[model samples]
Target: MASVKVMRMKLGSEGLDVSAQGLGCMSLTPYYDQPKPEPDRIALIHVAADLGVTYLDTSDIYDNHTNEMLIGKALKGGVRQKVEVATKFGVSFENGREVQGDPAYVRAACEASLKRLDIDCIDLYYQHRIDPRVPIEVTMGELKKLIEEGKIKYIGLCEASASTIRKAHAVHPITAVQLEWSLWARDGEAEIIPTCRELGIGIVAYSPLGRGFLSAGSKFSENPYEDYSVLSLPRFQPENSPDLVTAFKRVSRITQAKGCTPLQLALAWVHHQGNDVCLIPGTTQIENLIENIGALSVKLTPEEMVKLESIASADNVKCSRYISSRATGESSCTPPPSSWKAALKRIFFYG
Candidate 1:
């Protein structure tokens, strides 16, 4: 058997070492809408770590804390010391639907996560979603305290704007900023990448495979009932939309022509974005996890990079990534004019 591959990067001035590619644990526990059994989820995580995946991501709200507990179980027996465990707090579910984040709530949330994970300190603790109700500084202040208390070794923010990132960095050195960045979602490249570079903060990209669309498998289609898939996005909708299918096909054609899987192409693209950028595409299957980790070896030549850029630009991607309203709630880009055509996208993400 091939040895597990290791991908590593440094977080800003802190110089904390992290994986070049990580695992997102949310899907393992069914944070999206459904639930995967704890045994299966824990087994999958152990397989990732056994395969040399060092960076693992989870959030407090996932399966209402089940994800963390699952990870804690898997990390016992010294497995925790062998890898980096990154988890997020903040963004609570109210009425079983809405997510709320407040500064006070953030402080309390971190403590709750620490207890559940059963760790002396978190390798990296992130603010899962920006709480618009509180200033970025106030929210960051709570994180800074955690770091001071040795509860967290590093701080990160997910799905935050460049401006918010700047404010948070001023409060304390932000080691990494997690964002959704894939071939299908390029909004973060515009301003977010530049900001991270300027501040010396590392970029940790989630959904680097376009949530499996870029992989060498079935295309993303909708089930009016299966809310968790890409089809729920306004852009993926077959109506009132620009030609997303055409673009996806174009991506397929380009990657196929390159003699590589779309997932490999997409991951290579993310890796090429910058030296400080890292990717964390999650998968439950051991084969898929191994395949994604193999992306570290798929280097793209300068000419090939140009080819991909040209094809993607020519495709003129259309549609909103998340539900139109939530899309605006936490991004730098403007939603499409027809965003109102869709309702809150329901992705049946059960881990």
Candidate 2:
């Protein structure tokens, strides 16, 4: 394998520079499944840092905080300074519900993440999801306080709508907006992504490979509880799986011709978006990590980019527990939520 030299990306004009690509560390610990042995996972992080992949992403809600701890353990042996650690707060997966953006909890969550991470100051901290019930200004206010206290170096938001990203940027210069952007998921492009670009904020695309659908030589499973499962996301339900296959075929034609995997093409497309765009693809195996790093080498032609973009829309990901439970003999996927405010409250607060 050749030495990987990744480009650098600036998170807007905020001066938060990260590797042009990142390693999403969520899969190394849990949530994706039972993690690989601790030493193996730690070795993967070391390898990634050695390969010039520095931007690391995690969230407090991932695997009950074990994800951050794993990174903390890996970075202890003089590897901490080599990587930029970015973790998220504001959403509690405790007992499966609770969107916490209250000022007090924000403070508490930051403290907890810092402790678990064993790091003095986080390179980037993000609000996992906005609590629509709470005003964006209020949450931004808390984040601003953390910055002033020198607990976090940069601030970001995830899964935020375009209007919400703009409003949040008003309170503080959001270094980046973390959202899922891949050939299969282009919701951000319609509004959220452009909003970030317009404001000069950077975009950190998570799940850049379309939740494993674009990965080469890897079997994808649609069941969340099964082995190979990637589900837990409403997008991977049975009804949506076929379209994922079709989308894969569309991209494979180009990858196969280029001697690259669909995953590499998907990642290169994200990079081709602009210097402001970065991708964080997660995996538990070192081979896949190297494969992800190899994506940086696959430069696409203008025609290739156009082809990928033309077939990028792989059906909208819209399914609710309400719809699923209502399905008697067969299941149906609906269009993206038109007015999800009410449904949002029901989901985060009730269920």
Candidate 3:
């Protein structure tokens, strides 16, 4: 196997730098399916580091805090200095669900994450989900306090709207904005992406493989999401899967020609979008982890990029964020007019 050497990218103009692509640690716990043994998970992280994957993303709500602990344990034996670990603090269990971004809750949540991760300071800290109840400034204000106290080195937001992004940035320089960004989910390109570009906030493309849908295609009878019940989600349903597969055929032609998998094709497109973008593709298996990093080797020509753009147009992406898993509901992700007249989008995220 060729040695992997992942480069680094700067997050906005905040002087923050991290690995070009990050390892999404969400699947290390049972939230995805069956959790791996503690030793296996730690070994995977170590292997990822050896492969030059040093930017790790985790959240407090992932398996009720086990994900952060998993990363922390892997970073032990003086390994923490070798990598940059990013974690979130906005979401906490409340009333049997998530309540996030409150000022008081923000302070408390950061403290709890710090204790769990067994770290003195988090390299990157994000508000997992915006709390509609609080103003953007209020949330950013609390994040600013954390920065002042040296708790977190940089601030990031997940699933934020353009207006909210501007308001929050006015309070403090946001280092990055993360969203479900992939060929299958291009809604963010309409507004949030442009806004991030304007504000110099880096784009962290989470689920860049469309929750494994864009990556797996129809090759496997076993539902990759079987453990998480992602099959129950509208976008992953049998009816929608056909549209996704058809939309990907054009890109599939390119991947076949290049001898790459759909996963690498999707990741290279994200990497080429701009310097402002980075991706966190997650996997539970070591082989898949190495496969994802292969994306770094698949470069697209200008014409190939244009072909990908047409394939990823709003019209081609056929599903919405959270359409009712039931058949009666309609899909919201169908492409809008050349103008972005789509309904005002609110961040609809669950843990």
Candidate 4:
């Protein structure tokens, strides 16, 4: 395989530098599809690292912690030192699924992630989801303590609202805000992106390929109705799939004219958003990983970006980004701190 050195950029003003494109490890498990052999997945990670793709994104909730373990095993024998390991917490599975961002849970989750990744300090740690019951201050307070204790280097939040992000940053400078932003998912552009830019927080875009829809179009799933994950997403339903597929086809025609694949065009669109925006597009296959890296070379001119945007604008895209009732994007704000004294005590004792 030819070596490709991906460009690097600073995630936020906090001095953390990573590849402009990162490898999202969610699909390495059986979340989206059946799992590939462990060795093959590990080799994919190795190849990504050898190609200078060193930012690895994973979460504790993925496959009940198996995904982090896989990344841990892959990073053994000095590979860990070359990469920045970013894993998330806050989505709790105990006592049924729930989001936990209280000081105690935050500390416990970070400790568990550190143990699983087998790393003394995480390069970047994110709260996978916001817990509405907990104040943003309370969650950020615990993460601040983790930074002080050398457990985590930088802080990030996934699917956080603009207000939540600002409040969290007030508690401690948020290094990055991870949200689902792509040609089809433009909800964040209206507010979250500007807020992050205003606060000097970097943006990490997940699902930049529209959960594989932009890449495969109507063929995203051979059996869309039967695929549990695909069915769970409202956009992949029969009604919405046709319109989305039509928009994708129009975009595909443009990519063909640009001499690139639809996947590259989708990713390149996100990359063109700005230098502060980093994209983590996950893939289970080595060929797909290599293809994702190719997006780095597919530069888009201003006119090309505008033309692509017109084809798959948010208005043209169908259905909500997710079908779940979980807090997402602008809806991720949390309640205000009820009592500052009580919250501080928890931070003090927990810290």
Candidates ranked by lDDT, best first? Answer: 4, 3, 2, 1
Determine which window of 10 residues in candidate 3 has minimal summed lDDT: 338-347
Error of 1 at 272 (Å): 1.3
Off by over 4 Å in 1: 1-4, 31-37, 95-103, 221-228, 240-242, 325-351
Q: Candidate 2 residues 1-351, lDDT tens each?
A: 435678887877899989999999877766546787999999989988888888999888777788899988988989998999999988875655578788888899999999999999999999987886789899899999999999998999988888889899999899999987877667678788889989999899987876666784135523323453344435555566666556666777888899988788888898888989889988888888888888888988899888887776544333433333222622354423543444444333221
Superposed by TM-score, candidate 2 places the C-alpha of residue 236 at a distance from the truth, in angstroms, of 4.1
Candidate 2: the clashing residue pairs are none
In candidate 3, list every pair of residues with a backbone clash. 314-335
Q: How many backbone clashes can be found in candidate 1? A: 18
Q: By how many angstroms RMSD does model 1 differ from the true structure? A: 4.2
TM-score of 4: 0.89
Q: After superposition, how far is residue 155 of candidate 3 from its true place, in Å?
A: 0.5
Per-candidate TM-scores read 0.86, 0.86, 0.88, 0.89
Instruction: List where candidate 3 sits over 4 angstroms from the true fold.
Output: 220-229, 324-351
lDDT of each: 0.73, 0.78, 0.79, 0.82
Residue runs of model 2 more than 4 Å from their true location after superposition:
93-97, 216-228, 231-243, 314-351
Q: At residue 339, what lDDT does model 3 achieve? A: 18
Compose the digit string of candidate 4's lDDT tens values, residues 112-136.
8888988899999998888989999
- Model 2 local distance difference test score: 0.78
lDDT at 250, model 3 = 71
**Evaluated with TM-score, which candidate comes out highest?**
4
